[model samples]
Target: MERLDGARGPRSPDRRGLPARGLRRGHPPAHRRERPGDHARDRGLGIALSPGFLSAFVFPSFRRLWIGAFLSSIGTWTQDVALSWLIHTRIGDPFYLGLRTFASELPLVTFMLVGGAQADRVDRRRILLVSQVFQMSMAGALGVLYGLERLGIGAILVIAFLTGLAQSQSAPTYQATLTSLVPHDHIPNAVALNSLQFNLSRAIGPVIAGLLLARVGTGACFAANVLSFVAVIVAIARIELPPVAALGRESLGQSLKAGIRHVVESPILSALTLLGATASLLAFPLITFLPVLAGDVLHTGAPGYSLLLTSLGVGAIAGAVTTAHRGSVPGRGKLMLLAFMACGAATVGAVLSGRQWLAMALLAAAGFSLTTAFSTLNSLVQEHAPNELRGRVLSIFGLAFRGGMPVGSLVAGGLVNAFGAPAVLAAFASALFLIAAAIRLRNARLRAL
Candidate 1:
């Protein structure tokens, strides 16, 4: 049998009474024992699924938080579908669509550093509560505008930008809280489960939104989102987080410098971030343009758009489950490379498929690849980061992850206007996957991590 360290163990003796060199004296000769570090590596990759894995999610504090977050996320997705549809109907301008993307993502680029510092300096639970309140208020405002028949493209953009700002602040605190909720050994599982919840909501949310949109109206979707935040807020109130450790005294500038230095020094992390940014720049803009694609390209309407969203969500959920079941990180570099390839191929296939069913299937394939690549990158970053700077590093990671969308939106909009949606998507997908594959082959650190 192959040994864990990529070395062969001693062979067993023949049927005769001849001893085998380096073999133990037994009928079934013992293989070389796995090194301690090898075992740890296996565990990190989710290869060893033990009973202890359950502890990551069953812990009371994390359970409440997870449940609350899942509920709120469902509402969040519902609102996103509604808002996208609303914008498509009101104004189908590609530049405006790009601006909508900017509204949702610009805050992360601007305020994520401050958000990270605040997560380290203040109470994370409180920060989450405040941010949830801000988001809920924005949702309520949108609902009111919709009810009053005063909602405009400008109003939606403004509200989206404001809510995104709140999300930027909340994200760092949310990520930091996971470490305190679970033991170190189960951190990988915890992260996977967290992703599972988000994707689960993603899977269900659009279906619900489609039903609600058909039965009720867009205003109902916004109101539902406003109400959904309450569950998370209450759950946050019910739980008690562990006390924060005293940080070493340092000036804000010094602390910021240290965080930057840490990220810069880690070649694996730096490469992962860069690769992820490129992929996001290429692939993430699809969500913003799905409405256009469904209506114009596929000759389908709202229900068709919902199906597209659901397919993506289902694919993401499948990817999350696959990761959880594997119980360890895989060869991330290879997986990432494969994911990019799959994503690119699927994108091209999606645009080319004339049949609606075929198009949805291609999109599902793309979604699965996209989510797996992203989740693997996230797990790697969290596993390797020091606790002191974890929040800051993750904030930078989030910034890279989300910030690419706006840039992609701009590029996609221009391409769609100049050439066409299919041509633009095909070109973007081809360039991105090819570049990602090249990067994976060139960067050893990215492969090994």
Candidate 2:
């Protein structure tokens, strides 16, 4: 039988039409095995392409989905900027801004695991479609309310929370769905391209939001975001995904426990997840304290802050491109470790440098290292995870990544408030460097990934 993705079923045949051999004991499954030159693409003319960063686009499903996601992500970032601007201009309180951030992020910490469980149990395509519709509705509501001059802080907070809740469900399902869209060899390229699109959108979206806010106003930004969802919704509706097979009948608590246990039992997964959380806790807070660094240390004010953020986004895009070009290169595990160290070192250099130009340059390097380490870690996790448990595993990763940000920012904020941004940030960067060094020295298995 042909799969929904237009590929032959596993039981179909070998290239010569004979039955495929069954797996032998002590041998890894065919999907899990990696061979040298696996990422290379050979055309009929005998020309070979290495790394094959664009190979995932050979599949119509992945290509359509990627284009849709790219458009939607730009809109999402636009809405984010618009929302923050709306809250700041209207509420005029730092406390409310922080509250909005917290509301928008809390659901990832609380409900992402549940979403992961559902990904394993139900139809992911439907979940994505529903999530897109829900988020689009919320964005529309915000736009309409603001247009009518009836938007309240309470209304904004509630909508933000609901939208975040939907994200908690959709994010893991989206991650889990990538492997289904392409063959195993293309997973790394697909994953890297996914990161590339996100970082690209992250760079482009804010600039668009700034233009919209300056010329047309916040209402236009929100309205644009609502319309952007149509691309992703249409793409999701069109993709012919393989049906999800239920993994188990466990209760939510039990399902979560199983995922946690799987991670705990596997040292590689546990280490990778911990490293990600550590980066979030220590390295990423540099972004949170950037304004302080700009105003206090650099003395560049708002324009400086914008420049610094732009530099970081540029570096992240470069890093994503690098990962896509590398594909499934060996020593990615070691590369990730080095990236952690580089990220920490660059962040420290940026924090210590009083010169604005030097600081921006260092921050760009930090952003590049951070993105490289993250995309590499993500590729490694996807490679090692069994399909049966992939959704749950990825959810744990998402939880660590998303949950760490708020907590880290909160702690880093307090520390900065007490000790000042430069001092606190320097210490955090130092810790991140030491942690990566220690992991590199101790985790031999991880180095082999």
Compare the candidates by TM-score and give the number of the best one: 1
Clashes of each: 5, 0
lDDT of each: 0.70, 0.73
Off by over 4 Å in 1: 1-55
Q: Give the Cα RMSD of candidate 2.
A: 8.0
Query: Which segments of candidate 2 are over 4 A away from where they belong?
Result: 1-51, 85-98, 148-153, 248-254, 289-304, 351-356, 419-422
Task: Point out the worst 10-residue segment of candidate 2 by lDDT.
Answer: 5-14
lDDT of 2 by residue, 297-317 (tens): 788754566567667777888
- Please write out the lDDT profile of model 1 over residues 1-449, one tens digit for every residue: 00000000000001111212233334331112222233234323434334433445444455566677778778887888898888888787766777877876788668877777766777776677777788789989998999999999889889878877877777766777765565665566666667777777777878988999999999999988887788777766755465444567866667667777888898877877777677788887777788888888898889998998889878877876776555455586678678888888898898778667988998889878877776666777778778888778877776776778788888898778878777888888898778977877787767775
- TM-score, each model? 0.86, 0.82
lDDT of 2 at 301: 56
